[model samples]
Target: MNTVLETIKNRRSIRSYLPEQISGDELETVLEAALWAPSGHNTQPWHFLVIQDKKKIDDMSSKTISLMKKSPVDWIQKLASREGYHLFHNAPTVIVISGRKSADPLLFPLADCSAAIQNLLLAAESLNIGTCWIGLSKFLFDVPEEVKTLSLPEGYHPVYSVALGYKKEQLRPTAPARKEGTVGWYRA
Candidate 1:
């Protein structure tokens, strides 16, 4: 396999992390990779909010769990009620990716943001940094007050968050088995 393929195969969503923070250079490299991701109409409408404060990260996790406990989904409620369940898995840093609103109906900020997130994840993995794509943060984003705290620029809304830090375990987890019949090819 080639370099990109190898990196893609090795990358995993890491949940466990060491308390130590990642280096500034590593974080910057990851963010730069995100910025290079292809965007719709080259709008490049993504914004990154990097939060390194443990207090703020913990508070966001607590608030998100509180909201999750009120969810109608039984699994979500159960997960939220579980003891010692931190939303970001206690990573030392969290990056919130937001997308700018576009008037064009065909423009999809979420799709563009997702591509950026992929690049960020891959870059972090290449650097041997642990990362988890945090969809659960959406619970916090849904709240207007919580959104305001992020201080995002006008017309941009939170899309997703990523938890980043040094891996707690030196050993990487084995990849899960791939499902078959998911791929299709059209040939002329």
Candidate 2:
């Protein structure tokens, strides 16, 4: 199999991370890989806010935990209990992805940003760097003003964020097996 296929097959969502940081070059390479993903009409409707500051990480985590606590779901309550209120798994770096707020803002930008995240994850896998999609940033969707502080242009918004770093351990969970033929392909 080709290297790309191997990378995809081995790629895993990394939640646990070490205190070490990823080098500048490796970070750039991963970001570059993300930007190369196809965008709708080449709008490139995506913005990445790379947050490495410990304070900012803590702030975001606090907010996410607060929101999760408010959630009526029992699973979230249980998760917060075991995880101790911190989200993003204490990853050393967080990349916040956002885009413009258009009539179909989410549809295009979400897809684009998701693709970019996937590219970055694959790239990180190749470089032995680990990344996991972060839900903390998205939890702040309740407050639009905070999103603006991220320097997103007018109408722009944050779609998703991914945490990056050198993980101290591998997550024990494995990807669930794909159900083939779930989506039927038909030729008439």
Candidate 3:
């Protein structure tokens, strides 16, 4: 396999992380990779909010868990109730990704933002940094008051978050088996 393929195969959603923070250079490199992701009509409507403060990260995790406990989904409530569960998995750094509202109806900022997230994940993996794409943060984002704390620019809304840090374990887990019959071919 080629370099990209190898990296894609090796990348995994890391949940356990060391308490030590990632280097500034590494974070910057990962963010830069996100900025290069393809966007709809080249609008490039993504914003990144990097939070390195331990207190703030922990608070966010706590708040998110509180909200999750009220969720109708049984699994979410159970996960939230789990002892020692942290929304960001206690990573030293958390990044919130937002997408700018587009005037054009055809443009989908969420898709663009998702592409940026994938790039961010791949870049972090390439640097041997642990990362987890935090969809659970959406619980916090749904709350207007919680989102106001982020102070995002006008017309931008939070879409996803990523937790980043050094892995607690040096050994990488093997990739899980992929689902079968998911691919289709259309050849002329």
Candidate 4:
């Protein structure tokens, strides 16, 4: 198998990370990979906001946890703790992905952003960096103004985010198992 294919297959969802920041060149490589993701009709509707400022990152996570703990759901409120989830799992950097506000097609924005993030994570893996996609923060969108605060367009909304850093522990990934009858072909 090709090196790229191996990297893709071996990559796992990293949950724990070291405190070191990714290097500038490695960061550029990951960003470049994201730019190459397939988009609908070449619309490329996705945009990324990279956050590395310590104070800002800390503030954002603290505020997010504060709000989430107020949720009526007991499970969610319990999980919104400063112990492990503070500063977005304590990763050194975060890339907030958003999409343009338009009516071309609703699914295009999400699909494009998803593929872009896959490329980013794969590229990060190749560079020995780890990335974890964090979707919980989207709850902040419950408030209208968070869109602008995240540097999104007036109407654009956040789609997802990826936390990036070096892995603190070895990620043990199980082999891919076969789906008994998942594959299908039809021609008539």
Model 4, 1-188: lDDT tens per residue? 99899998878777777888888888899999999999888888888889988777777777778888998888778889646777377889999888876776545788889999999999998887888888777666566666567766565678788889888987555756767988899989
lDDT of each: 0.95, 0.80, 0.95, 0.81
User: Which candidate would rank higher by lDDT, 2 or 4?
Assistant: 4
- What's the C-alpha lDDT at position 144 in model 1? 95
Tell me, what's the RMSD of every candidate? 0.9, 2.3, 0.9, 2.6
Off by more than 4 A, model 3: none
lDDT of 1: 0.95
- After aligning candidate 2 to the native by TM-score, how far in Å is the CA of 95 from where it should be? 0.2
Q: In model 1, which range of ten residues has the least summed lDDT?
A: 1-10
Which scores greater on lDDT, model 3 or model 4? 3
Model 1, residue 2: distance off in Å is: 2.0
Off by over 4 Å in 1: none
What are the per-residue Cα lDDT tens digits for candidate 2 across 45-136?
78888989878888877877777777788887677666455677788888988876557644577788888889999999999888888764
TM-score of structure candidate 3: 0.97
* TM-score versus the correct structure, for each prediction: 0.97, 0.89, 0.97, 0.85
lDDT of 2 at 90: 81
What's model 4's lDDT at 45? 84
